[model samples]
Target: MTDAERIARVQLARTKGVGPLTYSRFLETYGSGLAALEAFPERVRASGRGELKLYPADKVRREFDETDHIGARIILSGDEDYPELLGHLSPAPPVITVWGNTDLLKKPCVALVGARNASAAAMRIAHDMAHDLGNGGYTVVSGLARGVDTASHNGSLSTGTVAVIAGGIDNIYPAQNEKLRDQIKDTGLVVSESPFGHEPRANDFPRRNRLITGLSLGVVVIEAAQRSGSLISARTALEQGREVMAVPGSPLDNRTRGSNGLIRSGAILVENAEQVIEAIAPAAPSQASLFEMPDDDLDDETLEFSEEDRARIIQALSPTATTIADISLATGIPSRKCAILLVELELEGIAGSLPGGLVRRQN
Candidate 1:
C-alpha cells in the first residue's frame, strides 16, 4: 500500500466510532480507506445519526512520525507480516505496532499464561514447558506480565517468544519488567495494538489477552483462579477455535480451580510440553493454511432504509442481548439487512455487539 493509504487506515482506526468490524466493513464497501473516509458522513446520515467526528489527520500523521522515530512499524491487517492466525479473528485488530523480530510471528505459536502470583512449582513447569516448546519449533506467546508470563518468556527468549503488551510498544507495564521487556525487544518480539506512548488502562488487559490467544495455535493455562485473566485468555482461545490446554494443579490450591474447570469443560488436560505438542499437532496443518483461502466478499451494496424503517428496527431491540437471527425474525427484516442495521446501530451508539454475534440496545 502507498503511504497515503497507510495513513488513512490508521486515521480510520483512530476515529471515535470506527471499531474493527466497522473498519473492515468500510474497507469492503469502499475498497480503500480514503474512499471510506470520504463516504463516512453519508453513511452516518443514512444510519439516522447526525454527523460523526472524523479523526484528525494531524494526529494520525504525528502518530506515524512518532512510530518511525521509535523504530517501530505499524502492521495493518492486510500486511504481509500480520500473523495469519490472528487475522482469522472476527474482529481482529485493524492495526498493531511491532518492535523486534516480526519474523517470529510466522512460526507456529502456543500461548502460556497463568496466575500473577504463581507458585514456584507452577512457575517451574511453565518455564520448562516454554523451553521445550521452543525447542520443538514453536514460538511461545504471552503477555509480558509477572509470574508465569515472565517465566515463559525467559525460557524461550533465546529461541523465540512474542510479548503482546496491553500498552504501547514503547510503554512497558509492571515497571519492574523493564529489563525483561528490553530483552524481548532485542531478541524476540514486542507487539501492541495501542497507539504510541499510550499507557495501559485497567480494561486494556482483556483486549491484550485476546491478541495473546489470537496469535497462537492454542492456549495453555498453568495456574489460574476462577476470575483470573488467564481464564479469560483460555476462553478467548476457545472462542477463536483454538485448542485450550491446562496443567492439573493440586486440588488444594485455589489457582487450580479455574484450570480444572476448563478441563472438565472439554479443554485438553496436559502435563508437559509433549502433551501440548500432541494436542496442537493436528491443528498445526490447518492453521498453516488458515489464510490461504480468501474471505467471503461482504456485500458491497449499501442497504437504504426509510427513517420509519430505522425506528422500527430500533424499537425491536431491547437491553437484553438478542441474536441477529431472532431480530430478523421479529422485525421481518432480511438477515443481511439486519446485520447492516446492527452495525449502524453500533456506530450510532444505539446498540452494542457482543461476542457470539449477539446485539443489545445501549442504555
Candidate 2:
C-alpha cells in the first residue's frame, strides 16, 4: 500500500459514522482505501442525508505526525505485519499503533485475564501459568489492567508477551504501571487501536477486551466476578471461535462465580499450563493459516440496489438484532448484496452491527 492509501484508511476509521465493520466493507467494495475515500461522498449524497462531513485530511496528517513523534508505528488492516488472528474478526480493527516488537504478533498467543481486585492466590496462579506458557513458546496476551493482568505480564516479559491497552500508544493508565508498560515496550509489545493521544473511557475497556481475545488462540480466566470484564473476554472468545478455559475456585468466593459459570456452560476446565496447552493443541493446527482476503481478488464492482430493495431490507430489520442470512432469506436478496446494503445502512446511522454478523435497526 502507498502512503496516500494508508492516510485514507486512517481518515475513514476516524469518520463520525463509519465504524470498523463499515470501513472493512468499504474496502471490499472499492478494492483500496483510496478508492473507498473517493466513493464515499457520492454514496452519502445518494442516501439523501443532505450533506456529508468526512474526516478531515489535515487531522489525519496531524495524527500521523504525533504517532511518529512518539516512535510508534501504525499498522493498517491489510498490512503484512498485522496479526493474523485479528484479521479474522467480523470487522477487524482498521488501524492499530504499536510501540514494540511487532514480530511477536506472528507467534502463537494465549490470553489470561481476570478480576482487577483479585485474591492473592489467583494472582500467583496467573503469573506462574503465564511463565509456563511463555516457556512453552506461546506469547501471552492480556489487557494491561490491574491485578491478574499485571501478574500475567510480569511473568512473561522475558520470553514473550503482548499488552493490548485501552488508551493510545502514548497513554498509560493506572499510573503506577508506567514502568511496567515501558518494560514491555522494550522487550515485548504494547498495542492500541485508539488514536494518538486518546484517553480510555469506561466503555473502551470492553472494546479493548475484544482485542485481547481476538489476538489469541484461547482465553484463560483465573478469577472473575459475576459481571466482570474477564467474563466479557471469555464470551468474546466464543464469538471469535477461540477456546475458553477457566480455573475452578471455591464456591464460597464471589470472585469465582463467573469462571465457574463458564465451566458449567461447556468451557474447558484447566488447573495448570499443561492442561491449558492440551486444551488448545487441537485448535493450533486449524489457526495456523495466515488471514486470506475473501476471493483473493478484490470485488471492485459497484453493486446497485433498487429503491424497492432498500425498502425491503429496511423493513426486515427490527429493534431486535438478526443475522445477515436471516435478513437475506426474508427479503429474497442474495447474501452478498444484503451485506453491502447493511453496510450502507450502518454508515448512514440507520443500523448497527454486532459481532458475528448480527445487525439491528438503530433507534
Candidate 3:
C-alpha cells in the first residue's frame, strides 16, 4: 500500500462498522486503500448502516504521530518483513502497532495461553514449555496477562517472545505487567491490532486472541476454565488449522476443565514439550513453504485456495448452522462435490466444517 493507501486503510480500519472481513471486501472491489476509503460510505449505505463517518486524514495523521511518539510502529500485512504465517490469515489485520524486536516476528512462534489467574503447576508448565521451545528455536507467543502468560514470556525472554496485547503496546493494562511489558519492548515484542495509544477494552481480548495464534505455529493451553480466554486462543488455533495442544490437569480442578475437555475431544495432549514440538514439526518444512508453497508438490499443495474459491465455499453455508447438503444448496454444488471441495478446503486450510454441524468461515 502507498502512503495515501496506508492512511486510508487505517481510516477504514478504525471506522465504527468496518471489520477486517468487510474491510477486505472493500479493498477487493476498490483495489486500493484510497479507493476503498472512498467506497466505504456507499457500502455502509448499502448495508443500511447509515452514512459512514470516516476518520479524516488529519486525525489519522495524529494517530500515526502518537504511535511513533510512543515508540510503536505500524506493521501492515503483506509487508516484506511481516510475520509470514500471520499474513496468510484471511483478512488479517491491515496494520498492527508493534514495539520491541519486531524482527522476531519471523521466528517460529508457539502460543502459550491460559488462565489470567492460573495455578502454580500450570504456570510452571508454561515456563518450562517456553524455555524448551525457545531453546529449540521457537519464539514463544502469548498475551501479556498474568499467570501462564507472564511465565511463558519470562522463560522465553532470553530467546524471544511475542506478546499480542489486548491494548496498544503503549497502553499496558492490568497495570501489574507494566514493567514486564517494558522489558518485552526492550527485548522481545508486544503488538496489537488496535491503533496507537488505544486502551484495552472488554471487546479487545477476543480480537487479540486471534493474533496470539496467528503469530504462532500452534497454541498450548495450560489451565483454563471453560469460559477462559485461553480456550479462545486454542479454538482460534484449531480454526487456523494450526496445531492445538492442551496440558491435562486433575478433573477436580475447575481450572483444568477446559483443557482437559479439549484433550478428550481430540486436541493434542501435551505431557511435556516433546508433544508440542512433534505436533508443529510438520509445519517446519512450511517455514520455507510460507508465501509461495512449492509446486513440486503440485498434487502436494497441502491445502490452499484462491480468495474467490473461499468466498464461494463460504457462501454455500449458513451462519446459524448447516450440513454438507445445506452448503451444497447454498453454493449450488452437489453434495458429493461439496464434500470433495470441503475436504480439499479443510486440508488446504480450515473450511470451517468442524465436528457436529458447525459450518462457518475460518475467521
Candidate 4:
C-alpha cells in the first residue's frame, strides 16, 4: 500500500458509523480506500441518508504520528504482514497497530481466554496449557486482562504470545498490567484495532474479543460465566468456523457454567493441552478454505436502493437481531438489496451489524 492509500484506509476505517462490515464492503465495491473515501459520501447521499460524518483526516494523521512516536506499526487489512487467521474474518480489522514480533501472527495460534477474576486452579491450568501449546508450535493469543489472561501470557512469553488489547495500542487497561504489557511488547506482540490514545469503554472488550478469536486457529475457555466476555469470544470463534474447546470444570462453580455449557452444546471438551491440540489440528487446513469470500458478479449499479426501499428495510429491523435473509424475506426485497440497504442504514446510524450476518436496529 502506498503512503496515501494507507492513510486513506485508516481514515476510512475511523469514519463514524462505518463499522468493520461496512468498511469491508466499501473497500470491495470501490476497489481501494482512496476510491472509497472519494465515492462514499455521494453514495450515502444517493441512498437518501442525508449526510455521512467522516472521520477527520487531521485526526487520522495525528494518530499515525503518535503511533510512530511510540515505535509501533499499523498493519492494514490487506497488508501482507496482517495475521493470516485474522484476515479470514469476514470484516477483518481494517487496521491493527502492533508492537513487537509481527511474525508471531503468521504462525498458527490457539487462544486461551477466561474470567478476569478466575480461580487459582483455573489460572494455573490456563498458564500450563498455554505453555504446552506454545512449546507445541502454536502462538498463544489472549486479551490482556488479569487472572487467566495474565497467566497465559506469562506462560507463552518465551515461546510466542500475542496480547490483543481493548483500547489503543498504547492505552493499557487494568493499569496494573502496564509492566506485563511492556514485557509482551518486547518479547511477543501487542495488538489493538482502536486508534491511538483511545480509552476502552465497557462495550469495546467484546469487539476486542472478536480479534482474539479471529486471530486463532481455535479458542479454549478455561473458566467463564454464562454471561461473560470469554463466552462471547467462544461464540465468535464458532461463528468464524474456528474450533471451540473448553476445560471441563466442576458444575457447582459459577465460573465454569459457560464452559461446561459449551461442552454440552458440542464444543470439544478437553482436559489438557494435548486434547486441545488434537482437536484443532485436523481443522487447521480445512478452515483456510472457508475464509475465501464468494464471487459476486452482480454490479453495484444494478443493486441501487431508493428512499422507500431504505425505509422498508429499516422497518424490518427491530431491537432484536435478525439475519439479512430474514429481513430480505420480510421486506419483499432481494437479499443483495437488503444487504446494500443495511450498509446505508448502518452508515446512517439506523442499524447495527454483528458477526454472522445479523443486523439489528440501532435505536
Q: TM-score for all predictions? A: 0.88, 0.91, 0.80, 0.88
lDDT of 3: 0.74
Model 1, span 1-363: residue lDDT tens? 998998899889988777776776577656899988887787787666776778888888888888889788899999888888877776668999998998898898999999999999999999999999999999999999999999999999989799999998889799999999999989999999999888999988988998999899899999999999999999888777889999999889998999998998999999999999999988953243221113333454655656766777799899898776677778876665666566678888898866444678996
Backbone-clash count (model 4) = 0
Give lDDT for model 4: 0.85
lDDT of each: 0.84, 0.85, 0.74, 0.85
Candidate 1 matches the true fold with a TM-score of: 0.88
Backbone clashes per model, in order? 0, 0, 4, 0
> What TM-score would you give candidate 2 relative to the actual structure?
0.91
The stretch of ten residues in a row with the least summed lDDT in candidate 4 is: 286-295
lDDT of 4 by residue, 1-363 (tens): 788898898988998768888887677666898988887777688656766677888888898899989889898988888787777676688899999988897788899999888999999999999999989988999999998999999999889799999899999898999999999999999999898999999888888999999888899999999999988899888989989999999999999999999999999999889998899988764244232233455776676667788788878999998877678779877766666667777877788877655679988
Name the 10 consecutive residues with the lowest summed lDDT in model 2: 289-298
Candidate 2 overall lDDT versus native: 0.85
Worst 10 residues of 1 by lDDT: 288-297
Which residue pairs show collisions in model 4? none
